[model samples]
Target: SDIFGEIFGGGRGGRSTVFRGADLRYNLEISLEQAAHGFDTKLRIPAMATCESCKGSGARPGTAPTTCPSCRGAGQVRVSQGPFSIAQTCPRCHGSGSIIPHPCAQCAGSGRIKLQKTLSVKIPSGVDEGDRVRLSGEGEPGVNGGPPGDLYVQVHIKPHPVFTRDHDDLHCEMPVSITSAALGGEIAIPTLDGSAKIRVPAETQSGKTFRLKGKGIKGVRSQAPGDLFCHVVVETPVNLTERQRQILREFDAISQQDSARHNPRAKGWFDKVKEFFES
Candidate 1:
């Protein structure tokens, strides 16, 4: 019947339509250090795979599918109503062009089975948040001999304990002793590689920023590595002993005598207040 209708171009092609498979997405989370340095990982994905019971033929043992006798291997059938003919899917074969009389017990005549598949993925260095790593032909199987779709791995970076990332740069707060802020010292700071010493000049004030070159992450597109910014936070001495309190009182008395020279910023601030009130 299909051969007779095709000779007049009134029936569909004998084969089913080819369609690409659907794409898939997987969320991948990694540490900041891993994001800085590339790593390879394996993923266990569960999806539809070709049945091994009947070699994806959906047939029972020693049996095979046969062409639909109603549609004559054509997925579509034409119905005639007096003078007009309407083409529709073959109800007998369900547009498969063939009928599986003895269905496979494993796949249940679907020609596919749910199974777990292992896939390898490579995560490049310096991959930021929301970056996608695509793997070709790693998605679901195609339909009717069509091409398979792709799988996308979305990257997410875990929060760092000490440092906060800003594009390629890194920022961190470094607590300094009040004496070190008043005097000079060489202190150790944390970097992505390890620890490094930074010289704190005399009279280093709070909120002062110290930049260390090439101490931050080298991004994927960056030719050179970024810098690390250290914010200084002067911590005041607490739980002072009686001797220390007495020494501080003596130091304060001396500093007050030369307040204009020792604390020029404080002197300037009070001068501004005095002028504002006088005006």
Candidate 2:
């Protein structure tokens, strides 16, 4: 039976004659910070492993398998009807050329069992969404002494609260009060590392973008750090007190007295509208 099993290129009911292990994939979700900076994490996955009790032989203790007699250890049998001969796998041994008389109780003659495995994965810096980390030989157990498949860990970055990423650059909106826009001042802005001060120029209008060099994320393939763009948005005062409202009204009256100097953009826009209407 041993010689016949060797001749048939099949193990003695220990391994599969034809099938290889299947690869596995797992999705790992991480924060934007973790994606920007490398992180180490552990994953618990359910997978197939070789049965310890059977030792991947599919036979009970102290027992051995015998070659199939149905196909004379050939793994396949021939059927003839009139003019043609059809070759088919022997149903008794399922083309393994061997049969396990006493099956292992743990794996139920499958030579493998489902188990939970723990694997540590390292996520590199600047890994974006859909990037995969391959762990070699960490997948399902192979059959017929073949090599195990690989495990792929897919990355998914969570949405950031303040910044939006574009390649290596970061963009965010900074809200400035009306007073800060009117009178130049320094305001603290958030960055990846920490907060930085940005100068708000006098009479700075809304939608003005300011770039901070080397304040963005550094990619894995990038030579230098990217910049951070801060778009200034002038916020209108809300919930104003009666005294503040009166003061604003007085200021508005004064501002209207010198509209060309105080509000040149508004005056120019009005002039353009007046010209268009007259023409």
Candidate 3:
């Protein structure tokens, strides 16, 4: 009959034990555009793998681990500390309850080796800064036929130069010439894909924003693309020739006389300031 005894090494009716390994973590940096879209990346990392020479058993190739005689295969030793009797790990077997007579030379009985490993990971779309991606069973190898640990890859997205991104939308400055802004003309605007034409309405003021539908980043939660906000910045003419400067001076003079027609906002602000000064 298979009847169990005290089970503390009594009649040898206990279950066999195994060893497990430790987990690992890594960090990765990607571009902001890459985060908007999913990407495949590879990383090189240093990890501990099981020794092949002894098949991770730590004993020599042909020899198996034998029960430790020092602790009688119990993996612990009784220590009487003053008024207490404490059971601590056996020094001979390191609490494994077994000893390798002929240890493997490669890992020196540590059962693992330090080596560089390359792992490929797939980054999902809409992953933001400080996001973590878990890779199962890709950490340190298991010990003594145990299950391996997990690998955590922390992600970071680099800042973009031209665009500022929120959750799904993008904001950027679009420079339009003074002539084009006032007279109403088509100007080239920069986008993620390429340059596109956006019409500047007549009398368009600086700091005004225009939205381009379906032109921003696409989020995983919402397939509906975000809008791209183009903030208007009226750029003054530069590197003007003598004739161009004269023409601009004449234009400025003509536009300055009639404030209501040309510069209504500025004229209204100045009129308020004059009224305050008079009061």
Maximum-TM-score candidate:
2
Worst ten in a row by lDDT for model 1? 1-10
lDDT of 2 by residue, 1-279 (tens): 445434544333322455657889999989888988889999999999999998888898778777788877767766664555556677888777788999998999888999998999999998888889999999888876677889999998889999999988999999999999999799999997889999899989999999999998888788887899999999999999999999999999999999999999999999999999999
Among these predictions, the greatest lDDT belongs to 1
Task: Please list the residue runs of candidate 3 whose C-alpha ends up more than 4 Å from where it truly belongs after superposition.
Answer: 1-20, 275-279
Model 1 local distance difference test score: 0.87
Ranking by TM-score: 2, 3, 1
Worst 10 residues of 3 by lDDT: 1-10
Model 3 C-alpha lDDT per residue in residues 87-184, reported as the tens digit of each score: 66678877777888988888887778889999999998877778889999988887557788989999888888889988789899988889888898
TM-score of 1: 0.81
Backbone clashes in each candidate structure, one number apiece?
0, 0, 0
RMSD (Å) of each candidate, 1 decimal: 4.1, 4.7, 4.4
lDDT of each: 0.87, 0.86, 0.81
TM-score of 2: 0.86
Write the residue-wise lDDT of candidate 1 on 183-270 in tens digits: 9799999887889999999999999999999988888899988889999999999999999999999999999999999999999999
